[model samples]
Target: MPEHEAGGSLATPAHEVRDFLRRRREQIAQRWADEPLFRTVFTASRDEAVEAGKAVVDALARVADAQQVEDPDAAGFSAVREQLARMGAARSRAGLSNTQVSSELAALWPPAENLLVAESDQASPEELRAWSTTLSVLLGTLRLVAMQTALSETQSLIDRQRLQLLEVATPVIKLWDGIVAVPLIGTLDSARSQVVMETLLNAVVDQHARFAILDITGVPTVDSLVAQHLMKTVAAARLMGAECVVSGIRPAIAQTMVHLGLDLGTVKTRASLADALGHCLHELGTNIVNAAPDGAGRR
Candidate 1:
């Protein structure tokens, strides 16, 4: 394209943007590094940072070229938008908090404006204005993309933690030769109960246990809701061919269950976890007793 030739302005806005990006890319990155967020780091290596800065400049140049042809949300800008999203997620996973990411992104606007002012000073007034506006819109789009990535990644992390807690909370221990006990401590909600059911059933199959105990001694209350959860877990265990015994019925909880007319019919109940395990051994025709020492027998 031909030059403006009057005041040494570029022929078009795109040309002007490309010229500034090529000339002042280093200054933009240096400015970003001076920001407090980058100065302290949660950043990648120096080479990675420099490469990322160059990619950003290239992305912005593309944005300027497409400004008149498309908006940030439109198909024309999808590639750059996706690139920014990846960048956002990468930043989050690298241990940058939302505040740090925001600070760095917000810090970008000033250096960008400075780049245009210092490097493109001789551009036509209209072309300069268009370029600035285009950059602002693209930067704003990137900011929004970053926020969305943060939200999505945060939610993912929460889900993983919840799954981990479920695995830890519901453990089925093999208590005897053919007995397993699932000693539930907290209040049993529907979600937790599902985990309990799955754990109990899997243990029954895996351990070849003949009896399973659903001990709820640590449960704080026995409302109808909680009673239902217990019943579901028991049913799941029986379906897997192992008998289930409910344990840890406090006086108050028993009273509540009776008052609520919960027909836990035919499901054996024990006052404590020890009672449940003892009963399991009894059904197997064996009872545990402390063995006297060889020398002190009958003394």
Candidate 2:
């Protein structure tokens, strides 16, 4: 062969080696592109892809070093073999073999490059699905909290109304044929007094009573407002064809009533419930027997 032809022949083999390396790299990349694991890694976060790519590079480097060493007994070859063994042990611990790692590495090469180029903030379907599930849980928790708050507020309002209603709706006892006794227990405000007046008037008409006993024995004190309310109640009882008997007048209450200048001309006065009952019997032409109480009907 001619000298130039010999050189050209030698260069042709080098060119072929370069071409072979290029073809092998391209083939490995394409094969990885078709793999499901490659696609998953590519679509994963950049940090994940980079980590997987590094594992693949370490594996390839170990295999390359083993192949490059010549004699197995030589120092370099022994060192390479030890490195390969250590890499193998690591791969085993990681739940993969050398062959499996190589295949995965080849498959993931393209995705690794893509991951490097892709934006970090771009979210994948898996990430979005996870986020949506988290958001749904949060919204459900918020709704539960809101419902609990509403229920608590409603219960509080109902409790307050119940207490107010109890103050106004407490039952009275009829001590005589014509006289009924109502014991005031708590603060007798104007609003509460109006309710009490209406209740007493209704009871008097229903029972056809000639007299009612307004007893304030349990009451601590009286205000001008309460005295005015009592006077109005007496007037209302008179309009309903019944008389009122004021009883259990404490010293403070008497002083307040006198100070307020409330006239009880239409109503009778008594010192106690028994006195009111006796007076009512005198007016009604009746007497108390060994009988059960009025409110103690067949319940």
Candidate 3:
């Protein structure tokens, strides 16, 4: 087999990259520790960042040894994926876009290249260029992997936040001793509907309420899907030993329901939240009377 020689040593670009990474792991890590990607993330101490940088160097060495420097899915990357993800996420929290994070990663290249060049002082220009290219490709792949992981983590965070917002928006208010109400104000998708159902049912059991009201005046439109969700929520409340009332059915919404042939016959309906509360009060044997013009109580 033929051999590529650099400084009297037989070494291909891959072999040189592997050897360089192994021989100078400490130096590489120390230098990288000061980079924003590592420094900002491992804030407790400089040593922590240095250690994290060492892990990345080790992973790159493994990739070079395996001759898969260009492969993002190379097994070498598995060890440092979580670490890279954390770094990426931290940069994101610092208001760095993916492009900016990538640029920061690119900044790590010069220090490594300089070290490699110093060690290759006796090597020919062609050999040094080849080694530099190999290292650059490996580091570029690392950037790709980090960005991928960061995007995934960001999406997961967004999903969690959205669910939390839905829960917050669909708050179940205890309107009275034996009545609870959920005032919904937005588009009713399946996810929000599920949240509404779960929250309303929980409130029913917690409050021991006899009546539950779902006010949808703020909901602009109701499709068949929305109707189905509402029916399911009402049925669930009924099973939990509470009667559910649908309120705030505007004339336009009522017309829409009629046109769609959607039935709320099994569910009680009211024109407004005030009317629903009035019905609940009537069922609970409560009464309201007019007060005098003065600040006296009503009889």
TM-score each candidate: 0.70, 0.43, 0.76
Tens-digit lDDT track of model 1 for 41-110: 4255665555556666666666555543224343434454555556666666678878778767877888
Using lDDT as the yardstick, the better of models 1 and 3 is: 3
Off by over 4 Å in 1: 1-23, 42-48, 64-97, 119-130, 185-192, 206-208, 218-226, 250-263, 284-299
How well is each residue in 1-299 modelled by candidate 2, as lDDT tens digits? 11222111233322322232233444434444455443453454544444443343333333223332112232322322333343334444567644564454343434423432242245554443332332232223222332333345557779999677766555667776666777777777777787788888888977777888888787777776776788888889988888888888877777777887766666678877778778888888886565566556644
- How far in Å is the alpha carbon of 111 misplaced in model 1? 1.1
**Model 3 misplaced stretches (Cα beyond 4 Å):** 1-12, 30-52, 73-75, 121-130, 205-208, 218-221, 239-241, 250-266, 292-299
lDDT of each: 0.72, 0.54, 0.90
Task: Give per-residue CA lDDT, model 3, range 84-179, as digits (tens).
Answer: 988887888899899999999999999999999999898888878888877888899999999888888989999999977896799889988999
Question: Model 2, stretches more than 4 Å misplaced?
Answer: 1-164, 167-169, 287-299
Clashing pairs in 3: none
Task: Sort by TM-score, best first.
Answer: 3, 1, 2
| Top model number, lDDT | 3
In model 1, what lDDT does residue 49 have? 57
Q: Judging by TM-score against the true structure, name the best candidate.
A: 3
lDDT of 2 at 134: 28
